[model samples]
Target: MILLFAGCPQSSDKISKPGSTQSGTTIHGEKIDISETELLTALNLTRGSQSASEAAKKIAAQTGKNVGRLSFTEAKSLAYDDEAGTFKVKVVGKKNGKNFDKTFNVTGFTHPYASPPQSAIQVEFKFDAGIEENLSIDKYIEKITPNLKAHLTFSFSLQNGKAITLGYDNDYYELTAQVSNSNGELKISPEYKLKYKKKLRGEDETSVSTAYTSAMPVFTGQKKDYFTEKDVFEHIFNKVKDDPELIVADAGSYASSKYAFAMVLNNGGTLFNTGKIAQYVNVYNTKGADNHREIKNITPAMDNVRGGGITADDYEGKLTVNFYISKAEYIADGNTPDDKEKSGSYTVVRSGFKKLPSDISSNVRSVLEFSLGKITDGNGTQDTWKKRRINNTALISMKYTGINSTYDNWFSLNDDLKITGDTSGFYLILNGQDYTSRMPNHQDNFLVPTNGDENVKILIKHLQISKNVGEEELTIRVQFMGGNDTETVKIKPQSY
Candidate 1:
């Protein structure tokens, strides 16, 4: 339930060559190994009569081909039938099926696109609602790649400055609740296909020295899936549900638990609502047999990213990107931290981010104008906003109009398709209040118009400022989508 997170913050330090090994945090100065990923997860089931380990066993038993069994075979689905004594194939939409690994692969593009709109993966798919044509990441693929979308940390950049995004599946796993498990149990590992096959050089099976050869596109993980909301509690279970009793968590007492994830809990959480049970997808403590507790009959972890050789955890920041100069630490297997059975490599990736310009030129400035400051937080807020018919509700707003120009411009068009919940087109900091996450005007995608638009000799729209913000000075940082450039607009009452 407690995940130990470790990583080096994003730095300009040079990284060692791939094929590294280490344990805990001690890198042994070597090539990056892909076997260190040992996914950690726990299963909690409510049955006052049963012990915690027993609850874990029952979930695993029912997950296998038959109920009351602990061996995983090729036919275990998230759904199962415990015939009072025996468990068997689960019926999904009337047909018995094991969750097959879905594949999504990206190549031909590099990280740090040479320009905006072009993805770092070079592959871009757009949404076509009528046909659901395996659409762009804007569609389903952006979701279920095992919970949270992959951050830029899992990517590596080549000399060409193009990055190969390996993604979150290359590092972490989410404890997802199964559709039927209210208090039953949720699979920690998501079912979207993100599993990869390791291309072992030979059949040694003992030595990982010749495990991989980067001859031609060694990444075997093919992309093809959707995004699913994940619980921060999954990443930190014990903290959220420290009590041994599942009913307590169900009674909503977990909400007041001092260590619960504030972000999720504060917004009215979706966890432990009717009580809870955690069904860890990767319960590797198979004290009886081999790969028995693995979810979906997958070997080791629920998928490769969780078990095979990758390891990652919540960095606990609004956003914290960490990279390691490819290294590996020695972990002594299940019994001791002395053997080298499993190892995964994480190395410092080449940063392809371009440095922002030191100054915004007048031409860029000419494109938009901030309205004269007539800030008001009067009680007639509803009437004022209603007059404008703005979609975003806010305490106060200022006009940021466009100037006549033929060039393409945007307010906060978030072009990065890889990350979710991060489409802040623009940010407003009134005094010291951070209003990046609550921008009503341009929540995610709002395109700017050029001179060609009939009404726009120049048309200004209001930028919503959140309630409770101080009126010291309004600072706006707009990320113009034209070329992924940022422009600052600072306004003071007297100055404006």
Candidate 2:
């Protein structure tokens, strides 16, 4: 399941500003400047077991109690009356020998006078009973259902051990919650000691990390379901544009499940050469001295395997790419060719996107040019060429089509061309001698196909590394000794 977070506010309103007393006369020459913001900040200083009202009370007691404050006193006492669902704070003081008073009322504020305390975080959950079609968020509820549930005992902690716990409960679920600072950031865990067992069966007990913290009051949904491509783009591209090496590797449930909701990174497109991540890991560049005797002079290589760079660039009217894919399944046609090593074929079926012209034969350059315009970073010369890699698993399949079909004599494997290696930055030595004998059953081959009988020579091969390093794709013009039969193909890497 893919979890995504949207519309989460980063900060709070009602900013605070501190200053000295204005308008009111000062008593004993002590200054007193108070705004709603300043009062909240000052009230936050009290130690454990102190409520806002209790803290306010402490402030009220100390007004003229010790600090040479303009004489002050609590004109009214706080009370927990069921009729009024809010806290009332009233303090009267003398400033500059003048009389003045301030009153404050807040609905969510704690009434220290009460026996039990409360917190600010309000956790809500939305569920779906049916399946979604587009797989976006169809069958899901916009906001949590009618259950105005609250956890009774909630606690959380950080990787470093610092944490906070609070008890909360309403009608449906009773929970003990804890939040801790995991390294510099906060981690929240809410465990429910749920009362109604059978009714909320699936809700028995689930420990999902809350995105809220002391520093940042916003609680992103549960960690597992909170990330999107926009989040990644904002954090990685916009946030760390200056640092090439800087990376935010999220190894949590939230980081991993984003693939489902991620539309920013298109998995299939023309720029992508290989199909899926597995396809790249399974590539095998078969080349060199394993069988054929007459075939010699082959150069092969594989580069940038693991953590290899994945790139999308415009090439000759196409969004050419160095993509990852599964291994190619090879099969040889059993046609009897004296020197053709049983003309074989290979199929590589990887799940990926392909960028092709509306008409394959149309000017490919036009498509490439258009793509470049869309991706080019402001400075112009190819800044949109970002590097990315995938380790996630994806499905892929391959099947070779031309196994044993006999081609018109001239198209025989003796001269039919096959080339491999180092295309994907991997290398394989390619240098072989062209030979032909005319004793009884001899055929002539062309450097560039002089005629139908004069077959154009081509090479087909794969390469393997000692410990399965990796592979890359290279673009080089391939042709016969003196002919023009050129096509671009990938030089994929393999593990074996």
Candidate 3:
């Protein structure tokens, strides 16, 4: 919306002289002068709703000059000054071989922003040379024809309880008339084309963004003048009222019917150093004692596993215990006869798990053993392992555990969600986090299921990971109900 006020001079400045060609020189070969008092009287008589030609004829009659002897070249009015109760109009006319441009300090002219009947819209005119020759309204209309076939359009809006006028300036040789619409918001854009002898020359346009007000009476059967704020609210409410899934409630309220589960393992084998297993169990027991008052009430026996022992067979088998232990010890008899009576204890252990221990619900001791037989049994590269770990972790972490159907559908339609990097749809997740921050405030945190069905569609909006991870295919697994059925969708690597 760049506004250019090019070629318009200040009203206080003198009107530019017509071209120096002999054709432009005023007729009668001598300068003619009309008294200011007579001119003022004629102008006053023409003030209220009189066409420019009618005013010209009256002025010609009073000054004893034929209407053909005058040319109305320019006219402009300053903004109304309420305190002074006056508005200034500058007019440039040609008469008797001389240019007569004068500013009339006028009172009682209707203010464009005045209230009710007093606030009528007015138009002042300017014409090219010789256009005012016959001095009739029809003759005036004939000279300045629109280049566009349509009538001049206008839009209106109220600013601070007053109408803000939008029109082209006088320099463009275009005339404007005021028409009003009751609803400002319904106003159409105003555009006009200038034509000469039916050939298009130029255009003038204006746009309005405001609520409409009636300058004149609206017809009896027309729609109400304007839309109220409540009208907008009800319109939106009616659109979504029938959708039961769009209602919002707390996630925990539906926990009885909804279930979400996730698990991750490195090759499905569990291992723990025997000497450090006791310390790990003790730590878990301490954490549960310090943090889990609710769980303590349900499982009071959880505190009794601190002194448990790990046998030599457990160490050889690489078994994983399901209870907490802080540390472990190994005691051996001294080898020398002198030291036979003395026994010493030493800690010999490897890496320990950092996560809190969970109850061992299964009894398979071989579950911790690798089916691949040994560490060197397969073609296991670090790059492949790293990529698999990253993909596995990402797949498990990306889950829509609960339902969210109250999101605004308007935002989903308009915003760019980058579905498949080529198509457009709602973005559910990016880099394992919800895409809610990119959406508007009213939209929910998660995407809704399509019509509350068992199948969930996950659009892979984007993928950005380390180059070392290579081109990995991702599998999205969705479980709608607890152990009922699972749906899987595979997404291949795509170029950005």
Q: TM-score: which candidate is best?
A: 2
Question: Which residue ranges in model 2 land beyond 4 Å of their true spot?
Answer: 1-92, 95-97, 100-174, 177-432, 435-496
lDDT of each: 0.24, 0.26, 0.27
Give stretches of model 3 more than 4 Å off.
Answer: 1-80, 94-105, 110-496
Instruction: Tell me the deviation in Å of residue 167 in model 2.
Output: 8.8
lDDT of 3 by residue, 1-496 (tens): 9997879644332212221111222434344454444455545653333322233334434333334455556554422232223333445566665866554444442222333222324222332211112122333334434421132323233222433233544211232332234333222223222211110112122222222233333211122122222222222233323332222212212211111100111011122223322222333333332221110111101011112211111112121222211111111121111222111211222112111112211211111100111122333343443253232322212223332332222122222222323121122343332323322222221222221232331121112222224533444443321122334444433221
Candidate 3 Cα deviation (angstroms), residue 169: 21
Worst 10-residue stretch by lDDT in candidate 3? 293-302
> Top lDDT: which candidate number?
3
Could you give candidate 2's per-residue lDDT for residues 93-136 as a string of tens digits? 65455555555543333222222122323332221211111112
Ranked by TM-score from best down, the candidates are 2, 3, 1
Clashing residue pairs in all predictions, respectively, total 46, 80, 16
* Decoy 2 TM-score against native: 0.20
- Whichever of 2 and 3 has more TM-score, that candidate is 2
Residue 219 displacement in candidate 2 (angstroms): 18
Of the two candidates 1 and 2, the one with more favorable TM-score, higher being better, is: 2
C-alpha displacement of 82 in model 3, angstroms?
Answer: 3.7
